[model samples]
Target chain A: MTESLQGARVVIGSIGDDIHVVGITILGHALRNAGAEVIQLGIQTPVEEFVATAVAEDADAVFVSSSNGHAAIFCDGVRGLMAAAGADDVLLYVGGNLANTAAADWSEVEARFLAMGFDRAYPSRTQPAQAISDLVADLAQRRSASNG
Target chain B: MADNVTNERLTDDAFHAQRETIFREQLGRAPYDLDEALAFSLENAKRGTVAAVLQKAKATGVAAVVPRAGVASWEGQRALMQMLDEAGAAYLPITIDSLTRELQFAEAERRLASSTTEVSALNGYPIVAHGIEANRRLIQSFDKPVIVRANAVDLRITAETGLASGGTAFVSGPMYATLEYSKNTPLSEGISKWQYIFRLMGIYSEAGVPMADDAVGFSQSGTCSVPALMHVGVILDALIMASQGVKHIMLYSMLQGNIAQDVASCLAVEQLATEYLHKLGLDDVSTYVASSDWNGAFPERRPDAYGLIAANVFAAAIARAPLNYVKTIDEGIGVPTAESNADSIRVTRYLMNLIGRQAHAWRTPEIEFELHLNLIQARAILDAIIDLGDGDPVVGSIKGIGTGILDIPFSPNIHVKGNVLPIRDASGAVRFLDHGALPIPAEALEMERERLSHRSADPSALGYQDVVDDLQFLELDTFDPATGTEVKA
Candidate 1:
């Protein structure tokens, strides 16, 4: 277990109409404090902007957050956008209060997001900082291995 | 699997131990069994019965309302609106989602604009999206105050959105840091996230805007040692964290099967928690009674009319809580019908207007009634707190206090009953404390209606099955032979 997040380029932002930001901000601060080069995309960013920012900055991870129950939509669009931008290999993380509609099977929800290429999916009320740090560290290790 | 189980247990114990540390460190005591603490509180309540929290809300000009968001179908929103309308309660309707694809927020806004219904837009749900400009624009589009829900996992978004939209308020939940606490995740990670959410809360509060911090969705269901106590602690911490500018923390208590041994048990927990908050110098914190009695009386069956009637009575018992925004009975059964919703309100209103006064002494320390209900629980939990030295109720962390047991357990359906992991280990021998009855289904309503409407007094009463058979045969034969074979499978 190495501290790979140090200087890792990570882009944190919210996608789609889901504008819940507290979780993301927390993640950003944690990542920054962990010594990551973070591009905080803020809330309600279009998919194109995220992809552009990631591509332009050559970021290691694309973290997306949403609080409204439609995490599936957020995950799907971000996955699609990442694919379109050929940044599909970037570590994709999705989280938020994604399912408050009917009582839902969140495991299935998590699987669905995973299938959409997210490395992880967080339930709403989940801690985002941990995920950000984990994603950064994992990506940094991978990057180091590939370059080393 | 066994290793995983053991590992999980270890994790949970660690979580509990950690929680106990926080409780002891902050509140300076060990956890008390919920029943005991609640008992203490009830004893105190008997000595003095305060006016219903709603009376205070009415008198104080402070409002505690839940922003209900409907599904894209808009039915939830509509139902919420109708309930508010009938209750004569003004509320905020915010559109929030964890998923925003397919939804054109602009289009939704446009449609919302067209409707004659009164609705003010807030950031809506999770508020987690990268559309910074879009989110900002959405918030800016609404002239009314917008609430920004922030947590450790989402502080970056909060800061950005706060800067962009000038966040007027914030809603923070306490379960966030414990995401990994109950899970197999590393302990360090959970601690860091916990610290992170706290930091975010501080930021939002220090920013000078009011925050409606949530106490605990964690205590009743998750990794925390004493869910209820921890929830109370978190809320108290949140109030203190707010450092004065914070408007009102919404204290939420759902009637899970386990929180209160009965309805009185439920109310006892409520009263004790509320009193605890009051003691914490958080006089401004408002409470809302969203009794998740979604499970009617029967845990095994659908909505029971009797259970519903009982829930109304229970609601009346803890009227002393800061806010009582009771959920309609039809919630657990299915989507509540408009008539059912009205019936629920009428029943609750009737209870409030009728028996509520005579029941004023309902919180008396001792449980005179053999039956346990919300009020009894309220009294009992209060007693538990008193036993814990009657110290101020700590909000965020439930480390040592036994009153933590008083936390309202959420429906098992949301936690363990469904696909979600069970809160406790299966092998662990635990007391099967009868919390209370859960709700039944809406179909039961039809069955009851049929039983009542078509029943006969004689031995040859037209039973429901008999009526269904008659209807089936009639449909099969068709009223007219010309319509024969028209009934497809």
Candidate 2:
């Protein structure tokens, strides 16, 4: 497949009090392999930092990860921050254990993120390649819609 | 004075009574009978208790090889254990699944049942979710000492289930569990909970049931070079276990890729642990060194990873750790197959036997020098902790960690300052780039600084990128020590 994500810059990190860096690092490697320039903020990044970095870099998307099961609490104000920063057009993605309860429904988690202004929400077990492919498609769609 | 003494006695009595009540209530939640549990464990035990296995190792001068392996279903776990046992594993491990580790029994139960059809449904054997009878069946299926391995901070219930169901040992220590696994857990709370687990072990010991407690070691700190920091963690845990009257304690250390440093660290841990326990007035507590093969990041290539594993196992064998925890060749790839697990055990056992036979010829001046340096550095860290606690290592550990006096680099725990950073010296031994608030002695600090200064002229360049590079150093063909840059093959 072609490097569809060529020249695209994506900002990724673990949000809030979550300090899981391995998953983000792995994802960063995968994204880079898929030809996306990944700016990894490492772990325990606040929502505002992600927005600020995305705006500063004029990034294509903001990818967030959380493994401490407090994603909802940590990612609550991200959409608002983006809107206030006037960067609401940036595509936002989140994945990993998104709630404290292990048995929380995935559909509910996705809906919660959607309501919080995330463009897409992946499950903890979603493959990095799959996430990157979807992000590429979504970015293409957003670009076409904006041009239209 | 009499009134004050009476009031203090009343408070102590009340606290003990409440604690006893809580313990009873927790125990009552499950259908656990100590006698029945002991009978089940004894019947299922093929290689006797963990203590017996270690004793055998000591008497025979051969290290016991234990491989970490578990699957979701009882049958899968049994198959895995049977493979390792047949391959000559002296001890077996029943690693708990993430769900069971988090105390989510229902999910673990569902996954355990589903794992029968879909083998990949769960990552480990959920001992608690499977209940006592299933655990008994799994244990009875194997003839080796089976230890329950989990990141259990509050392991009272887990320990009860594990011991009652034929697990002779459980892997965890308060500081290691709290700081390594549970990022938000308070060290004090973790210690109190572990005290209950230790009390349970003491009860079993009193009843003539052999039990062992393995403290989580510097293995959790990854590749960062802090032998003293890791040794102090082991000693602190040993002291806690001794305080709870644990008879057998295993002070574990991981292979940090340097033979002299790893050997020195292991020897120092055993020496210091024994001395510290003796000083604490716990002369009956027996301690042994249990070395784990390379707990750091592994190379992606299977051949390279196997080579690294073999090297680490050789180091552990040469170190003469009574118990050696072996990791499979497929560690970097993901969960290893049962055959790979068995292969790892066989390889480690062969190497250990070779080393044991050549024990008399295995003396080196370099090892002696490293050992002396490790002992001094470890003693300095431990002495500082004791001073911090006002003669109590336990109290001092809590205060030391709380105030960043004893810091672990790259710890996920928010409470940990994480300001301490470790970088490798010219010879690839770990040394602190930034000591942070570690209360190490001035001489030890100077020695570490001097060692690092020899590696790089610009020590200020040692920061986040250095750690990232060091974590993946094994994967690179050649690593530039000065810049921490990797040249791919």
Candidate 3:
């Protein structure tokens, strides 16, 4: 079965001061392959840049990746920034070494991100295929909810 | 003569005391009473030490397989170790959790406590958080020697605690930790901190403790193909450790896929390290070649991944690496289950035993050629680093890395230029595509260039795409030269 994210535009990048671009590059490639138009900001992307670019491009989603384990600290209030930029409806996802502590509870981490206004959160080592599939489903759900 | 005098001055008691004070302050905690820890460690040392096991393996001509493993709770880690021990693992590792590695002791404690009641969030054992007593219990629970594998920049506390708490060996080097692991940590700072660690090892050795200290080699760059750079780094670290009085040194080399090249790299590192240590008047230092199966990205396909894993096991065996860090079949697929971890060890043990029995028939001209080339190239790099440091490896390594004379590919350290690029030649042996500022001799550089030229019309065509392809080569079943697309086997 094929799930199409045909006209969906997404801004993808590694947020915070993290220069690890490998994960985000793979994520961007997977999103693109899944038929989404991905605008990758590369590594060490400031949260403001992600929000601004999403607003400018009218992107459907903003996905932030960080492998340096400081994603929570760097991504704080990023959801509020998107809201202030009037892009609150945009789907938000963050993943990759998301917390400094390796012993962090994924459910708690996911809850923390959800409370921070992210639509989805992935723990460390989440495969690209799984993230892509989740993105497709989330995008479809958001579209359906908006249509209703 | 001047270098020897400098070495003497550096080894003075007052100098070490001052350095220890600074290291203690950096530790941000009081130093654990070494006497207490050493007594306990010495008692455990009687049962079996990592050094003894390795020495026994060397004598028996058997490769001892050690798996890198850790979990949140003591029970979880114990269970994992027990599983590995039952699978014929000679030595096991208490791989520290990330929180502990980053010195978040409180966080690790909380996680460890919570993980017991709930599913653990930790990737490894939180030895620091668990403290000395708990670590000792964990070690005593396992019959095999337990080694500590951590990536902390300030390893003073970890070293003291691990050595005291029944950890038989600890692995780290300034260059390996700074360039391969930390981003903001300066090479000088890392070197100083590791100097303190080496001193701690020295104290244990002085007490006549059979402790093993490993100078992390190719595993640092983890898949980036710079055999000579890795060899130089390992040997330089060995010299520094020897200066600090570490008696048993394990020089590591990661497998690079090519069987002949991998075996040659292992042998070359062993020979170069021994030669350099002896030249530096460390003849009493016993050195061993430790092979890491593969520290890089692994194949996603199960069969292919197992194939690669088996290949590495064979390479380690044929190379006669006494210590082998076996990677699980579930590598590149996130943290492995206890079952998979044991399975990997079993496979490695089987391969090592089989190869040991049939060792005499394994020699070939290809192997000799690779070994010769590796030794020459590694020696050239080593000589350049020494010359750069003015005949002192400690000063030379710092200078070598400070200058771009020595470079590791994909290193995150800001000081690291990361200009050197590595690509596989036609025979799948890693060759320098762009030597960058690496100070290898002209003959070696020309030889590498000539080797790569045979693979592609434009030897310098190794751009970003080529590196990306090379990184993902194992995952791909076959390469279509024209389309550059991967075809599944």
Candidate 4:
């Protein structure tokens, strides 16, 4: 299962004023264990940084994480920026507390980010294994698509 | 290589020149003058400052209660302070907003003046946006001397604004600010920036102002079971400030749950800092200990939260910490309201009175062991750090932390992979399951393991979930003092 991401380059960070480091740091460690090259841009990252580093590192995916539900403030238009940087093939994923206090439904939060151009969105309380497995499958599918 | 930072004291010319930039360019106000500042300190000396209040608390043997407070509008902030003061706060805080802390004054100005809900509303008052005199008016409106609380990337400009606004003290020194507050900056740069901050405090001290500098672990590290090394951060914080000529040093330790260890952390910081400062030939500096109550999870119910507050108050009285940074019953929820903050102070005040009379049962072998253990853990690291910096804490911290000779990580708990925090031993006191990158002594490490082994009857078969139980330990521990076997309702 982990063979799909063997030596895959991934960029992960918590964007905006969200200084939630523990969750993302744990995710980075797990990704590293799964044979992925994880470039950690810790907390309070801007959108341009996620794009610039992904482009510079030639990363296969960019994972934007936030626990503050201020995603609408920072995560909006982020994938478009990555696209503008001419890296549209690079997968964009965001997770963790994507909705404000009023958000009662996880599906609605996921759909909001998907509309904002994220390939997928995970809600709060997501285990590290779930996100890792999704990334592994997504990378495998992308590899087949490119080869075909 | 770190740029534009140094351990050298700023010359008079350099300080004056820096002030021009700090007030005018940074704050959009007239330059701050040494004469006016000196005169202001002299003027305010009779009225009493935070240091004076703490000094009096020391003299009277009272553990004074203080609260953290700020809001967007001056009227709103003044009213909050007024309510807290009337509710019995010993000293107040001018908690600066996030934008001001990050040096985003223009944005803060726009947000403060803009009648729109356009940008996210700032979390606290904008001291710089309100300007010096405006802040002075709000501060002087209250009776007690205020402390400027901020987690700025560089506190030099913020300190200047805060001092000019009649704050008798500035909280969060270099080591505390950098490791705890800053996300990506190097330690040396924080050292360099805080050099200016201490020089500013030195300036006030030279002018006969009783200016105090506080060194608390600025990190949410207080939210978890902070290692014994957290006290080292406190001592090193004071060393960095004292080296820069700061006179009065205030050391803050957070309570991480265990009553004995929690109290020991504060005592260890005071005793160790005094000894080390004396070793450095800076013995004139007086050290005071202050303890902040739990920064961790609180039960959602207000009554339950009050029980937790009462437990911490008992801890403070036991430790005899001269000042206690109190927490509201709204800890498990969002930012506390003025009424809630006042309620916390009243509860703390009442408990201090009740607990002050009954404390003969507290001085036990457990407390002595915890205190001795705390000193041992902190000294081993400090000796290595000072030797690494060639006897200068300011230089040592920059070089030592940068080199990992002082192996505190981006998070203070450097050993925590996957963000797993330090877990507890059998007695519910947090002991490191893995020492990680911390340089705690070998015997202490053995003692910790031996203690932690008690959590399982068959110590060898302890499961992963057993260790992880500490995360939710406090949830059921609401009104922790009431957990005594005989005290159940």
CAPRI rating of model 2? incorrect
Q: Give the total clashing residue pairs for model 4.
A: 0
Ten contiguous residues minimizing lDDT sum, candidate 4 chain B:
B412-421
Q: Deviation in angstroms for B226 in model 3?
A: 2.5
Order of candidate numbers by TM-score, starting with the best: 3, 4, 2, 1
Per-residue lDDT of model 2, residues A1-148, tens digit only: 6546888899998886555655686688779878899998876677889999999999889999976555765688998998899998888999876643333567887898899988889865566878888988998888899899
Kindly provide the TM-score of model 4 when superposed on the true structure, using C-alpha atoms: 0.81
Enumerate residue pairs that collide in model 4.
Answer: none
Alpha-carbon error at B103 in model 1, in Å? 17
**3 or 4, greater by TM-score:** 3
Worst 10 residues of 3 chain B by lDDT: B1-10
TM-score of chain B of 2: 0.90
A7-71: candidate 4 lDDT, tens digit per residue: 79999998876666656766787788788899998878888999999999999989999764357
Candidate 2, residues B351-408, lDDT tens digits: the string is 8888767655655776786777777777877788788777877677777777888778
Minimal lDDT window, size 10, model 2 chain B: B1-10
lDDT of 2 at B403: 83
By DockQ rank, best first, the candidates go 4, 3, 2, 1
Q: How well does candidate 1 score on lDDT at residue B175?
A: 41
Tens-digit per-residue lDDT, B72-160, candidate 1: 33333444445544653323333343222223434444433433323222223323232344444444443333444333322433333
lDDT of 4 by residue, B1-489 (tens): 245444556788877776677667666777666678678767866678888888888788777899887776777787888898899999888777666777878877776775232223455788877877889788788778899887655877778878877899888876666676557667776776777788888988887887898877432453455445676778777877887788887787777667778767767778888889898888989878878878755565687788778877887777778888887886655456788899999999888777766766777889888888778877887888787667766667666655565654336222222222366666667665544545678888777767766775544455444443444455455235675422111
lDDT of 3 by residue, B291-347 (tens): 887776666556777888888877778888898888887665556777878888888
Q: Pick the candidate with the highest lDDT.
A: 3
Error of 3 at B354 (Å): 0.9
